[model samples]
Target chain A: MEWFIAKIFAKYNYWISIILMMIGFYGIVAKDNLIKKIIGLNIFQTAIFLYFISLGAVKAGTAPIVDAEIIRKGYVYANPLPHVLILTAIVVSVATTAVALSLVIRMHQEYGTIEESEIIEKSRDKGMTWT
Target chain B: MIVSIDLILLFFVVVIAIAAITLRDLLSAVILLGAYSFLMALIWVELQSVDVGFTEAAVGAGATTAFLVATISRTVRWEKK
Candidate 1:
């Protein structure tokens, strides 16, 4: 029991992120609504961001801002590389969400309903096969 | 401790995530998703990624939510069961 607890404490951040990732995966796979799916995608993306940020964490570390005093003492800083990468990721995520919402809007305009099953049914009536 | 706080925030994030998906009302779900994004921004800041956190707060909490709400207004409000 002690070993198990120790392991959990040592790596609980990863465990939590894994749980979140699984939840988002379930949402993307099981949910029928497109909006829910988009939200799920966001959750998944955030979880990934969480995991990346956690990977960059350091014990007794400060932010990556530079200073002469800190340089003299060899102060450790949190990884700034992940921060930069995740900035790009955030922009991409927003762009993707916008495009997805616009697509959803277009689908609603075409079909008059946003439900996946209803859209599939309507498409079938129009002699379109599931692709 | 920071670890405990992180765990607690993670718990809330998970709960909000589940609620965002399971909620019957689409508007409520979108709002909840925005809240989730804000909480995530907090976590990123706590992790010392303030730049990422700022972007998340701006894009995730602000732009994404607005886009979702606009889409909701243009589309159906309630999810069909």
Candidate 2:
């Protein structure tokens, strides 16, 4: 394939993450349903997480377990810093999803629909103008 | 070898993510998110972050999917558009 011969990417991870991030961003910005927006948000977050973890990868590196054997063998451990931050980020993403879902629940209860456009129209009809 | 496992996994992840965003059935998208998260965990492991992968499996794939399913059941199964 001309695509492969093109050598379009040497580091595939970053490009993959960027493509995923754009998909998520499009979902968040263009989708009509609130649930889809949340899904998009999750994808975007995961893209960022992947980018960070991939940045920390080193050739022939092992997991950052810090064992004696690894030290004696002089193994280069994958950078642990990004992993720790991503751990926190994943937990936070879950929390954000929970909160957003709960809010969507309440929005459906009040407006009888989860479509963002319909919700906005309803609010306008009800004279609940944003200030 | 022309392709590595990383490229394969990343390609699959991108395909699933696109499907998830484009699908009209909300429930199907939620399920696709679970798959995406699982593949993401595998990639993390492949990248030599075992602990991060473990957390992604437990939290992203497991708990997030459960929460989304519950919320979807309470709300709607289909998107307006």
lDDT (Cα, tens digit) per residue for candidate 2, span A1-131: 77785676767788898999999999999999999999999999999999999999988888889989889988898999999999999999999999999999999999999999999999999999792
lDDT of 2 by residue, B1-81 (tens): 123888899989999999999999999999999999999999999999999999999999999999999999999898874
TM-score of 1: 0.95
Segments in model 2 whose C-alpha atoms lie over 4 Å from true places: A1-8, B1-3
**Per-residue lDDT over A13-119 for candidate 1, one digit per residue giving the tens place of the 0 to 100 score:** 78778888988898889888899889989999888988888989887778788899998999888989988988999999999999999999999999998888888
CA lDDT of each candidate? 0.89, 0.93
Q: Model 2 residue A32 lDDT?
A: 92
Ten-residue region with minimum lDDT total, candidate 2 chain A = A3-12
DockQ, Cα level, model 2:
0.72
Q: Which residue runs does candidate 1 get wrong by more than 4 Å? A: none
Model 2 clash pairs are: none
Error of 1 at A90 (Å): 0.8
Quality of candidate 1 docking, DockQ = 0.78
Give a tens-digit lDDT track for model 1, residues B1-81: 277778788889989998998998999999999999999999988887888888899999999999999999999889877
